[model samples]
Target chain A: MIIQREAVLLFAGLAVVLAVATAIGWTLKRFLAEGAPHPTIDNLNARINAWWVMVVVIGLGAALGRTALVVLFALVSFFALREFLTLAPTRRGDHLALSFAFFFVLPVQYYLVAIEWYGLFAIFVPVYVFLALPILAALRSDITRFLERTAVVQWGVMISVYCISHVPALLMLQIPRYEGRSLLLVLFLLAVVQASDVLQYVCGKLFGRRKVAPQLSPSKTLAGLVGGAASAIALGAALGRLTPFGVVGAAGIAAVIVAMGFLGGLVMSAIKRDLGVKDWGAMIEGHGGMLDRLDSVCFAAPVFFHLTRYFYT
Target chain B: MRLLPQLLGKAVTGLMRLLTGAQARWVGCGPAPTQRIYFANHTSHGDFVLIWTCLPPSLRAMTRPVAGADYWLAGGLRRYLITNVLNGVLIDRDKATRTRDPIEVILAALGEGWSLIVFPEGTRNVGAELLPFRSGIYHVARQRPEVELVPVWIDNLNRVLPKGDVLPVPLLCSATFGTPTRLREGEGKDAFLARLCRAILALRPA
Candidate 1:
């Protein structure tokens, strides 16, 4: 796949925005927050730095063509699943099934995506993996909390591998007239979701008072939702060129992405609360884990992919 | 000449770190470069590998894991991996066919300026509670009173690659090093082993 002109423009625009963010973070730290214990500013800088690393990684993957991007997301699913199952109650009985999930299910799902086998990749995890793993676990006959254990394993593969795999699966869509530009659809989804996250965090700090759900996620607030989601929707409209969707369509889709991404974070937070962990795993700085960073993407990607395929393709 | 073994050493350590996070928490003491014995609970065969990978590379070269000869010497590949790649010390479990005393061989490794990773639990404990510790740790510590015994708790490795599982699931695992204790001058064998056992179990993640 040749380097599309639109993709290059999108990348350059993202790089400029990241550079500006880095400049702001450095200025705030070097002058305003110097010699003082400012956790928020430090955390903001750390988050910006992590974003730099992530952009570089995704850029490199896109540069290498279709196979590289699929492989990269395969690794992403692998790490995210590892973090999810770490806090889960997987006993000795679940070993075989768990190994199969890691070794067999993960790579094959991504392989199907890479080859653009829409039929197999679509139902592979939801149909095949969902049914097989429980049988494997039941073979060991460890009947203590059997249903709960198998359900957690199913939920883990669904969220981590099946859901997250849809990001790369976006590349396989053959949208008419938007040929060779489905990569931009990926860019749009990521931009809207991540922008919503950063905006929500900033809005929460500035004007948030009433906690949205103090039980599940303490940091989320009503003001953050309205302020952040509204801004991200506008950002999506501005990024309308990337998607086949025009300005209004872009904003409408961005609204869907924001709502799904918000609920996705809450669902993951509930799982963390149930498991009694502050973070999924300490894989990234300022970000809790691979799953923590990808939780919103995990929910947004599948919905965005299906929407694009059903209407646009 | 030595390049192949050295490369193999780094590769094995890298793979172990990748499979298990092999994250080292220096809770009690820093990973200071010193000739000390690290005694931990026996659960997975990967126990010592995790601990070995947790150590600083400068220390990893001089650290040797004490593995059972029956397991490590079972095949030609196992022999090559244990002796060449991992730099492990294979101790005989059966006394009938053994010529040299296992304790004496361990002491000889110490004399060669090598720190050892010993499992005091003798065998893998499939259950939640720790098994009764073997007396080898007491004897090794008693003879080398100068060596500090650092109790390491290997968390989640057993779950990472449990018994009879061929492949390890990529789970986050940690090896926590605790405060070093030494065998006192008048400490009895049972008392010394019991103390070390408690020290190891104390570092279990709450």
Candidate 2:
């Protein structure tokens, strides 16, 4: 009954958000269709439609509580890892190790988190799995770019699985007075990260002139970064009732998340540039893939997790 | 009983698509309802399944993979997967069995209006380079002259589930179907095979 009530409230909130976004998108479409079809407005409308779908899906998962939410994030990690490895230059020698990473290592890491084995969950992929995978690749006896190949797989697992897992792992945190409400922390992180992304895109399109890193990500701009971070921080502060953090604390934390998320997006963009592929895979319309959606979240999750664990827990 | 296998087939194909992330790219020709022989380079055991799953659901029902009987029939699970789930036509790859010709079996399956998927490589290769295609494709093309022979290049499957590996790693694999080629009146066996190989290879992303 409590879970049902929570689900109802979350769904209601999401419906309201979607309604407002849809209205804005419709108005923009109508206004921008006068002369020539504006590509930016069309893309924005597409992104808003995608956000509606993404929000409903994630909101349902969050409302379902621990197990379903964990499963949802696991699937996200699975697809994100798939997108990363799809473009990454992998050899036949890396097959066994990669198999272990996807089927065994990724699942086991999430399983540890599900079972609340905090110690193992923290170190499983980074320390144990990291050392084990390179050895698995070495057994194939293909030394051609062995280091690069192994590093690609290792970094992919770390970013996609290890980092993304922390969002749901937030549900496992034993924060004082935060019982039965850790799901909100997950939502908080998602909202801030996503809001930062959306806001950044909007700001960049409106008033962007100076490029952040033209070679890495042509879309990101300095004006977008400042405005988006400020907006996300404000939203985070307003949502402080959901967490143990007060308004000012939530603002500080939100700023940290936004900054880290920005860096994460940049880093992922750099990796994509190095790999010479655009947008990972075309799973999500306008967003590319699961990794593209979660790039900022990947960097912010670990930091938010550790911060929550150290201070609140 | 029939519905069960269909459901299982859908589930298996869905899982295969998710795990392999196999994107079906129709490069040279769009998908048609006509009977076809989708031949691809074999790298991993998952080649046929990846190619089969990439087909539109309407086409999936009619497309059956021509697999080696020795491999698929060895295990009970594999046997069920090949026969029931995939609706595979298992051919005895062993040359010792002179009883029924593998091409005749494929042709019989084709006679029933089902498209056949054949791996011209016969066996899985461990490298990026394609092994010289065997004579089976040439024979099949000769037998089913009306059926379209589409060359599919299945890239990155070797890294996803390489030879001798049971557990498949979740890597991005793609099945790129090229333009259908037909056997010419004067083309030699080696020339036809080489052309088929070239067609498949051309679909690979640079």
Candidate 3:
């Protein structure tokens, strides 16, 4: 009987989510019709298509609720971490540290989030694993580039472990109306953050004139920044009901997400440039790595988490 | 089963192009060439795959890779892939005498108009220096003097997938197809092998 009720509720929820996506997609189509160029229109259409698929998955998973969604987030963290380490250089001595990072630390961090052990999830990588992995490396006694090697191991843990695990850390939030909606919060953050990236690329291609940071990211532009951020803010505001935020409050939150997302893109782009690589790693089709997709997530996850925890909690 | 190998071939080729920027180009002209021997230096596991992947689809159908029967036979997955899908000619290197010639099998493949890839170096080596030819390739070449001897120099493959490493790291590679040479009149076996090795070494990028 409860299963039937849950099934009906899931069906209804999916229908509503798809309905909203379709409505927004059509609205964006109409908006594109006014002044957007042909290629921009086509690219935005492609993004919308991808967005629909992402939404369908997220919506269905959310309908199933907390545990399933956390598993999905954990998978994302694993893939992202895998990509991170795959691109990062390692030596014979660092093999143990690398193995531990990928196999042990990644699961432990996500498991903490899964059990709603917020305190440990927050510091497992930074505190315990962070200190421990280096000691494991130090014991090797085959120390070549001891400092540099340790730093790379430490940085891999920081970027892949600490930053990425923050996404699932959303589950610990305890808002009154949004008590069971932390999964929704994660979905909202990912959608808006990723959408802004796609929109900015489209906008920049169509109307980009002044390069935002030519040296760092030649493709980025100020026009893309304004247009993409504005669109993200609007999308965030419209989807405000997913959170405890109202229209104005949502816009403010959206602004923060857009800002951080842009910074995240910049930082990741810079990291790629430093590595003398075009992409982080070949994990995503036509895109680079796990970090390539989650560049914004890395920044946006923690920012959104703290903002919501401060105000809504 | 065939579809999976073909798909895997495409994926691996695509990956090689992406990682190493190594491109394969077939040279020389021939008409349904049969009983031919392709001899090159052995550097990485990719040596066979790279050569196999580079061959024309039509030609790939009948070609057999001479893999160590020991290594390929031991691993279950490797055995299936090599013996069945890859259609490799696995031979026992350790238990074999001069009479137990793998080249005879390659010669049989040639008699059936199937091309064969053989590594002159019996083992994988990292250095640029070509190891002494095992005389098996020479024996094959001598037996089939009519067959076109394609000298394939696989450069930087040692760096791409180095010795004792399981995972392949991307490094720029090139497979140079040098002019075909045959055993000259009255060319001694030792002198002939030396000349063939030098021809392969000459194909290295200056």
lDDT of 3 at A5: 52
lDDT of each: 0.90, 0.87, 0.72
Instruction: Write down the TM-score of every candidate.
Output: 0.96, 0.90, 0.68
Q: Which one wins by TM-score: 1 or 2? A: 1
Q: What docking class should model 3 receive?
A: incorrect
lDDT against true structure, model 2: 0.87
What TM-score would chain B of candidate 2 score versus the native chain B? 0.95
Model 3: residues >4 Å from true position, as ranges? A1-60, B1-65, B72-88, B95-99, B107-206
Interface RMSD of each: 0.5, 1.3, 6.7
Q: For candidate 1, give the lDDT of residue B86.
A: 87
Worst 10 residues of 1 chain A by lDDT: A1-10
Model 2 misses residue A196 by how many Å? 0.4
Q: By descending TM-score, how would the candidates be arranged?
A: 1, 2, 3
- Worst 10-residue stretch by lDDT in candidate 2 chain B? B160-169
Clashes of 3: 1
Each model's DockQ? Answer: 0.90, 0.71, 0.12
Root-mean-square deviation of every model: 1.8, 2.9, 7.8
Ranking by DockQ: 1, 2, 3
Clashing pairs in 3: B35-B110
